[model samples]
Target: MKNLDLKKHYIFFIGEELPQPEAHLVQSTNAANAAANLGYSTVLVYLQKGLKAIKPANLARPFQPRETPTELVKYYNLHDKLKVVPLPMPWPIDNFRSKFTDSNTIASKYYLPFHILPTTKLVHSRNWNFVKAAIKNGVPAIYEHHHHEDKPFELEIVNNPLLQIAVTVVDSIRETMIANGMPEDKVIRLHNGFNRLFMQRQPEKAAEWRQKLLSNERSYLVVYAGALQQFKGIDVLIDVAIKMPNVQFVCAGGKPPEVEHYQQLTKEKQVQNITFLGYVLHHELASLLQAADILAHPHCSGKAATFTSPLKLFDYFASGTPIVATEIPSLIEFKDTRAIAAWCEPDNSHKFAECLKQVLETHPRKIEGYSDSIEFVKQFSWENRAAKILSYVEESLRPLLIT
Candidate 1:
């Protein structure tokens, strides 16, 4: 490619096409960042992969690796100004060998053997090569990681003299990468921000969803929106549901069979007032947040759940609702230790229930107490986050600036 002007920046994302919250944050923020800076253009290059297992296959099937990139191109409406580069690397095999491979046999394998490679080779090949080219030509590129532990071995690629990585959350990951011999300077942590749309609370939309939950049910609603999995500690939440029959626990987001089984347990346990609305669209999330009195995330297990920050928290804060979270390192940002959110034991149902009750009795949706988070959130706004990212890109491209 030609060497474009050094002032502009580009972001290269290597992951599944499913529009996860973090991806939305990156895309929205970068665009806002570009718009704020005036002359700069931010390009989002999405590499194609199968729908993530967490989301239902029915929804995932249509947007296979080959088809999804086009949707993003059209979705963003980024035909003329924005560039969408689609690189279809075979699963498992794509993990091990780079596109610049010597043998066709190895390349044909596509999927990389997980246990052997530990790291995905194809990611390094296509993702790294893209970053390397951009960096060489004085353009700053971001290799984003939506989830943690998915790329612990990405240390090699992130630390490579060629690319820059934008990782979410900074709890244990910062230490983990440094211990793995990655330079502290190489990894940049961009805490996921709330969608710009959420900044302006759409009360009418909120009211519509509010009616859906409160109609013929209960007034006080407690919502948990995210993955339905063991690591999410939804089982503990179910147990809490059994204890608090009055509080309607509305479970939303993608659910696997095991998560569905948790729902069964709620029924088996005979816990009433727990409703599950399987996957929800992005627009609906805000209304749901507005309708709820609390945003509960009882995730207790997995590196992805524990160390990685929940993008939902940003929305929760944006919603102006009080939050109740399990004690996790990544959630330290929201933790006041003494006050604010009601924190409980990781997987203890009794403690979770107690915390929920305490929060309900105490924090009654007052905007003043949560002002810090609201103000903190101002920093995490898409425009501000983008500007910060733009600064990083400019800094990265500083040495190559041919004055």
Candidate 2:
């Protein structure tokens, strides 16, 4: 615990060690990869609880020269500077009440409970039990958090305050951190950025997904891509689709079960124009967005909507298409909304439909203000976001880092 080995930059992440596209997987991967690529000795410690339902990388078979990128763990081996330490629990733990033996009690320290999910019980990450060990020796730390259902570990941060910096998305979360005992200057608001992997498009991509999703390259499609959870306002989107019978409405991201639920809703409601394409990869998703006339963000007012910045917004901005989003807290954070999205009040199906119709009819490409978003979105790239965090980290670690 005396002189620290500052050679390796350690980031302790408490979550299931799943492949890309899992809840925190993409963001964490981007952060670590960015740090590694930027010439830092990066190590990500993934804390995994041995829940039977949790699945590790499924297609991660023995390597093949001609194997698809998705088949293998792409983040591994590619980055020389980055290392991953996965701590998997021996026993299964579904909730806080689950009995833990002496050997497996460490799992409790890495688990963060979600009050929204009935299965997840009251539990905060046992940072005092594990994360303290990393910092006790003077290894500087960064805690990146988004809005969670319940943050039991906020108390830990309030009590210990060992984190060098805390990166957050929403203003409310940042305020909460300061109120909960994290220093005001220590908390940084870093909104979600358009992923570089998705933004980098293929030459033939523009032509492929346009025809594939809409069946017509020239169709004026209004697209919404993200989860199909209740707070996402997918039902409101279906309502808008019903009103605008002529225009095509397409939704691209959802789990199989969630997609099926919406499909059933559409069928029961006799909605025909709206199409639900379940879970398209980013490469294909980028193309689909580029071809669309307008991008829709039908976010309802809720906990998820309040303190978290959705990644889809940046994707929508990068697409060069006009955005129509519900007037949620995140969208308004920019202050200047004229150039970005056609903002409307939440749960207003009539208003949303009318706004979409107007935007579609106006032919947003020709409009003067619509192109402003393209310029504004230049700053919202993953590389830029990662660089910002890295800049902060470097400054914070400079005094502590030893050669």
Candidate 3:
């Protein structure tokens, strides 16, 4: 957050708690923390009510838990640079009884009065109505748009004169917005970034976890670290594991039920050499990636795969280890026209497994375009992403904030 103009950056996220385990919540925290690191005064306002407001949990401060805790932690700051405000439900109505179309109509009225500074600009990544509400209230703001496949960008959102900019995570999403009538200049395409933890030294516990995953220390290991969703092609990963018995496959994500579901599938297939260490925490995942021989991301095509910038892929990149991923634009971009990853079109299990084997067996000297990817990944750092968003606001939306 250095060399930037001095201004408070209001980041509104319509959620609760410090680390809720959802990708969006974690990223929102990252974005705000990065903004504060970039030298901006950042305020992270959680609009949800009924917060417990406990002391910041020091238990595994750096690691993000895989599941939300039953405990209540209403307030916590990020590095003491970002102020956190968890506003209890503003209305007497319970969430169960509330007729909320969106957070904007329900919560925007509360934002102005209790907001950090009335004059500051805002960057919101929650619901569209919140951004729309902010714009309606004359608060200069940009909406961070995640992927949406159901319908094209609505005419009202794209054509809104008050809506100055939209920050999307992938180029495909930016194109979608443009096709839906957003001006090319008004869209910012910032890819998801790896948490800095991945780039750090491997934890001392790596050897223990490695041995736990592989009884035979000599066996090769590949890991998939993301949620277990049907579209994610977890089934493909299972098939690959079944085909390759010598190579150990470890999956680290998903709820207990999801893990049990996969466990049952593995049993039916009689899969060997694969372990599901369900829901590894964020810090735990870094060492897990480092301990592995390869990072395998086998997500086949779908709307989720099409528009998402998977945080795990970048986590894999930061591991500086090899990756063998399904053919997808997002992963291919990480390849950066190089052989940094074994990018293969795996319409079937055999093809995907073959690609993995090729990556594992190929002579080290034969792989091409490896250096470019490592270089390409450096710019996608969360700090840089945050700085860019803040810089854009300072230059483009500052005047609009004069309300």
Which candidate number would show the highest lDDT if scored against the true structure? Answer: 3
RMSD of each candidate relative to the true structure: 8.3, 7.6, 6.7
TM-score of each: 0.69, 0.76, 0.80
Candidate 3 off by > 4 Å: 1-7, 16-18, 47-80, 90-94, 100-104, 112-119, 149-162, 363-374, 396-403
Query: What's the CA error at residue 117 for candidate 2, in Å?
Result: 32
- The clash count for each model shown is 12, 1, 6
Instruction: Give the lDDT ranking, best first.
Output: 3, 2, 1
Cα lDDT listed for each candidate:
0.55, 0.60, 0.64
Let me know the TM-score candidate 1 reaches against the reference structure.
0.69
Tens digit per residue, CA lDDT, model 1, 1-403: 2333322333333334434433343354334333333333333334344543224542233122222244443333222334333333334534565554412322223222211112111121124344444444433445543343423444444555545445445657666655555567866776766664444566677667767776464667889877776787777888888888778899877545645776687778888888888756555676677667778978775565556556677767777777888877777666763323777768789988998889888877542235544555666665565556546543534222111
Q: Better model by lDDT, 1 or 3? A: 3
Candidate 1 residue 255 Cα shift, in angstroms, is 4.2
Ranking by TM-score: 3, 2, 1
Candidate 2 — which pairs collide?
109-126
Model 3 — which ten-residue stretch has the worst lDDT?
Answer: 59-68
**How would you encode candidate 2's per-residue C-alpha lDDT over 243-315 as one tens digit per residue?**
9877788998777888899999999999988888887766567767776778898878876677656677877
Note the residue pairs that clash in candidate 3: 1-37, 1-38, 1-39, 49-88, 49-89, 53-74
